[model samples]
Target chain A: MRLRFRQSLDDLKEKLLVMAGMAEQAIQRAIEAYRVRDTSICDLVDRGELAINRLEREIDQMALDLLAMEQPMAIDLRFILAVIKINADLERVGDAARSISDRVRELQAFPVADLPIDIPRMASLAGSMVRKALQAFIEADAQTAETVLSMDDSVDKLNGAAHYTLLTLMKKEPNLTPQALNALMISRSLERVADHATNISEDVIFWVRGADVRHKMGEKPATEKTGTRS
Target chain B: MRLRFRQSLDDLKEKLLVMAGMAEQAIQRAIEAYRVRDTSICDLVDRGELAINRLEREIDQMALDLLAMEQPMAIDLRFILAVIKINADLERVGDAARSISDRVRELQAFPVADLPIDIPRMASLAGSMVRKALQAFIEADAQTAETVLSMDDSVDKLNGAAHYTLLTLMKKEPNLTPQALNALMISRSLERVADHATNISEDVIFWVRGADVRHKMGEKPATEKTGTRS
Candidate 1:
């Protein structure tokens, strides 16, 4: 029975990792769709969303069933709880991708222009954070999780800069308002993706160390030396 | 032992209700702040946010402890899980309030012209949905929960109308782009509040009927006829 429980836990971890991978790919694809104005990529993202949603439900059921059957305690209990939280974050990441894809579709319908800023960099940072957060979970590396958290600040700064720049652009050229607004919305969507990734990293740290590190922006995380910069 | 478990469950429920009330009030106050351009209300919303965050952590701990100690099955298990999910939704509602307050501050700084539509109605709809979701939880009334679900569509329509109006306003008077953007962001924040409330109502339905009615939006909820919808 103990062996079976361990096997189930491992299975749950594997399933979660799979979902994480799918979510990360969806974000990447959505951003690519936006950068290239590739409606085909957006279509792919829209189709891929169903798979992500299904995986979320499956992982949720697995976590709940494990809790009911094994009644995991201590670290094991925290792992399951973190899985539930992270699963929700992953689903929201998928939602962000869908949001971006929708924006891309809208942009396709309108005349396209060369955006004045680098959106792909923002998307890259957000995507990397999502990937690293999952790696932190798989490796149980608190340092990697901390890195994801610190990266969130950079994403927020970029989002603010994008907003300011877009506003200025709109002010100078009224004809560019719609396109600029679409770009701003895309930036916001990417920032939200980074936020979700940070949430997942926070869950990973909590699962590994049993510490609630959320909302403690200034305070040092419990696993500060592992990967945290400040 | 059973009585102790019951008491713990009741305690968790009470704390959640308090948090729900706090979030509902925060949304209402934030809207009032926007309408009156009262910076003090925004400050109050910021101060109240920390308390909401703390309550979220406390309720999370309580729910986890109950699950670990009582090993509740069936309806009891569903109730605890529902509390966990609802706790998250309420925290996010608090976040929506904070976002709205942030927009209020921006509006005060810019002093935009009068809005073209009724924003308070949007706020009232979102707040009432949250309140009704909580009341449904307290009474275990599926009908009330279903009503909240339907109201979400109304909020969505309001958001669409607001978005279109703001877009036209910005186009007609390009100088008002920043102000129009702030108004649009406020509307988006209110829409998010309503979405979270809808999530809470769905959780209530899941708690009562053990049915996953989230993705299956068209079907009538299992407990739809029993309770009065107000």
Candidate 2:
């Protein structure tokens, strides 16, 4: 029974890693779609949702079965709980990617306007936060998770700057409003991608330290306080 | 031991209901903040978050303790799992409220230029969804939960209309772009609140039916797809 439980735990972790990879790839493709003005890449992001959703259901069932059969105690229980929460966060990361893709598709209808925000840079930072958080989850490293938390502020600043610049662009050149609105929405989606990354890191901290540091970042924690700040 | 577990289950339900109330009230208050254009009310929405976060921690700890102690199986296990999932959704309902308040605060910075979106109407629909989903959870009524699922389309339609109108306003009036953008973000936040409500309903169905109906809505449920859509 002990050996079976350990193997199931390993299986759960593996499935989550797979889910994480799909989500990360979806975001990368979505960003690429935005950069290259390619709707076909956006279609790939949309097509990828089924596999992610299937994995979500599968992972959730696996975690549920583990809790029911294994009755894992202490760290084992925490680890499964963390996996469940991170699974939800990763699914949202996929949603954020899909949302970005939708915005990119909308952008395809309008002529490309040169916006001032560096979207690829912001997306790269958000993507790295996701990558680092997953590494922390794999290693159960609370320190690396904390590093992911600190990176959120930089993404938030970039999103804020993006928000200001996009709105200014809209006010100055009304012709660009369509593309600018799409860019603004895409920026918000990336910010939420960072938020999901922050959430994954917090879940890792909770799992490793058995501490609920979700709202411990500041007054209320940016994850819950102002998640859609762009 | 069985009696103790039953009592603990009731305790968990009551705590969740309390969390549900706070989330509902926060959304109501945030909408009121927008309706009245009052930043002070936004501050109230911000302050209430601490209690909401505390309850999230306490409820999660209670659920986890119950899971570890009771070793619940079958429907009972599903119920506890539902509680955990619902707890997360309620916290995000709180976050959605806070996000709306943030936009309301930003809206206060600009002069009140009446945009085309019927925000109060959209908010009312979203709030009703939350209330009904909680009602279904309390009663374990899958039918009521399904009704909540259907209500989501109307909210989505409302949000789509709001998005179109707001963008048109920004394009036509240029001067109203800031206010229109704020309205756009607020509409998106309400849409997410509806999504969370949809999620709660799905959890209720899963608990009662033992069927995963989350992504069963369409090709993919809007809750996990296009969640941040505006």
Best by TM-score: 2
Q: In model 2, where do residues sit more than 4 Å from their true spots?
A: A211-230, B211-230
Candidate 2 lDDT, B152-203, residue by residue in tens: 9999999989988988888899999999999899999999999999989998
C-alpha TM-score for every candidate = 0.89, 0.91
Per DockQ, the best of the predicted structures is: 2
TM-score for the A-chain in each candidate structure: 0.90, 0.90
lDDT of 2 by residue, A1-230 (tens): 67877887999999999999999999999999999999999899999977888899889878877776745665677788889889988998899999999898878789888889899999999999999999999998999999999999999999999999999999999889999999989999999999999989988987877644432534542232122222
Candidate 2 lDDT at A74 equals 52
CAPRI level of candidate 1? incorrect
RMSD of 1: 8.0
Determine which window of 10 residues in candidate 1 chain A has minimal summed lDDT.
Answer: A221-230
Please give the clash total of every predicted structure, in order. Answer: 2, 0
Q: What would the per-residue lDDT of candidate 1 be over residues B105-159, giving only the tens digit for each residue?
A: 9877674687696789999999999999999999988899999999999999999
Best-fitting candidate, scored by lDDT = 2
lDDT for each candidate structure: 0.82, 0.86
Interface RMSD, prediction 2: 14.9
